[model samples]
Target: MKKTLIVVCTLFTFGATAGTEDSGNELSYEHFVHSDKPIKCLYGYAAEKVGDHDAAIAIFEDCIARWESVYAMIWLAQIYDTGIGVPQNLEKAAALLKRGAHTQDEAGYSSLAKYHYGILLLEGRGVPVNKQAGIEWLQRAADEGVDEAKDYLQSMP
Candidate 1:
């Protein structure tokens, strides 16, 4: 655990410093990783938005391992699914989405996760096509206020 923390901290420190003026700031990445609140987990999104996928992947991987963060899982899943900064791996993407779906925290986040997982199932991206299961997941997402899921369900045949 200590080794992992050190590695994660190093990654975060470099990522945090990149494109920032804080060249010599003594920022403690461990504090964010160990914090009870997960405010810093969203940094991966900024990395993703700026096309720094390597940093995003590292940050999101940290978030999932440390906090099981829903958004991080979803973002990483997309990166894998789309081959963004890495080779496409549908199975990996689906697996991450599966974990996100089973996550008990963050209900709204789970809804979005379920919606994405349902699409993968419906399209057989990495798993066998199970329309019934896909529809069920989509329905759950719709019930939880996922607008895209509602639209998908409404447009279903």
Candidate 2:
């Protein structure tokens, strides 16, 4: 753990959420908490941004359970992958990416998880080295217009 953070404080921060929605930022208070006071995926980001990875993990798990938010899954995967304030768990991270891979958000955007999962599959990190499957995923990501995926595919021999 990076620092000891009170769970209550984290709960309060999530509950309060702090302001109106900004049009440009997806990570906004309004996105996390509405007048109905439902906890959304962005609540995890809020907690994480405030340096409470534990709280963020809890919130992301809850979001995944309650709403099946792909965004939450992806963010949580990143957290697990990077080991921010926690031990790196590539298996868990890869699992999250796989779970989120087929989901598209409101904007019809996806492929982010596919690319990461593809790389992990290729590296045999947390998963088996399934080169064919990895290449397929990379292809899917490239088809979806992920430049990084396209570049990766092109760079390969």
Candidate 3:
């Protein structure tokens, strides 16, 4: 009976230690998708959800700069532009959108192209007001199957 108890305790201790180590080694989005820093974008999102805009902005920016992932860049741009978790910076947003548009990520391309093109047309940001061009890009986004693009196209004047 003593031997059986010892064996059970050893197994329990080993399992607990192994589980703790595994949790410690678990990869966050920062480790898995972003850079070595703890700049997990989902962490940023969670922070934003809890109204920790400053923390969220910091994490989002870190994720964007560390990974340069299209999605990360987009989120960073959004946060900056809308003042979600950062100060509104239209220039930065446009720059990020341009970066996304120039990249090969189809989803990124569709999103950035349509939004930047449309906003530029409506607000005359960096480009000339070219409503037709905006429409064409939006159509391309819709054809590429961006959900917002389809809705935007359907709502177009």
Candidate 4:
């Protein structure tokens, strides 16, 4: 019994150390993008899934800088809106979403923009309170296939 216990503890300690070492070698978002194009999106999304918001945001920012795609803006807006990897700054999030909205054909910010903007309007966080304008933007997003906008419109009365 004593030998069995010692072996178990030794294996556990080794596994823990290995896990720590692996984590220390984890890549940042910026690195992920330049490291492998084929896996950038997947790696970024996976990092976010693991709660490394800063890394994910950095990766997305790099992607946006390089590609100028709305997808990166949308993700960045999400991070800012939720305060995932940084402080929650609705104004910055709104601005990014707006920029993305302009660049994207019709599906730029989607539900994220509408939902967060709607919440901001309700709370008057970043922009002035303009329920009407908020509703209009939300409707646009919904029409563009933002599911949250559809629900928002329904609740707007």
Candidate 1 TM-score versus the reference:
0.76
Q: By the lDDT metric, which is better: model 1 or model 4?
A: 1
lDDT, each prediction: 0.75, 0.72, 0.56, 0.61
Q: After superposition, how far is residue 5 of candidate 3 from its true place, in Å?
A: 46
**Model 4 TM-score (2 dp):** 0.65
Residue pairs with clashing backbones, model 4: none
Instruction: Write model 1 residue lDDT over 64-87, tens digit each, in one string.
Output: 888888878888998999998999
- Which regions of candidate 2 deviate over 4 angstroms? 1-39
lDDT of 2 by residue, 44-98 (tens): 7766877877767876877777777777788889898999967999999999998
Q: How many backbone clashes does candidate 3 have?
A: 0
Worst 10-residue lDDT window for candidate 2 reads: 29-38
* Ten-residue stretch with the least lDDT total in model 1: 17-26
List the candidate 3 regions with Cα displacement exceeding 4 Å.
1-39, 106-117, 125-128
Question: What tens digits encode model 3's per-residue C-alpha lDDT throughout 1-157?
Answer: 2432454455345432221222332433222232344324445554455576765666667766666656556656666678765677777776676676555653344365556546555565544567776777677667766777688878877
Candidate with more favorable, higher TM-score: 1 or 4: 1
lDDT of residue 115 for candidate 4: 56
Q: What value does the lDDT take at residue 105 in candidate 3?
A: 55
What is candidate 3's TM-score against the reference? 0.60
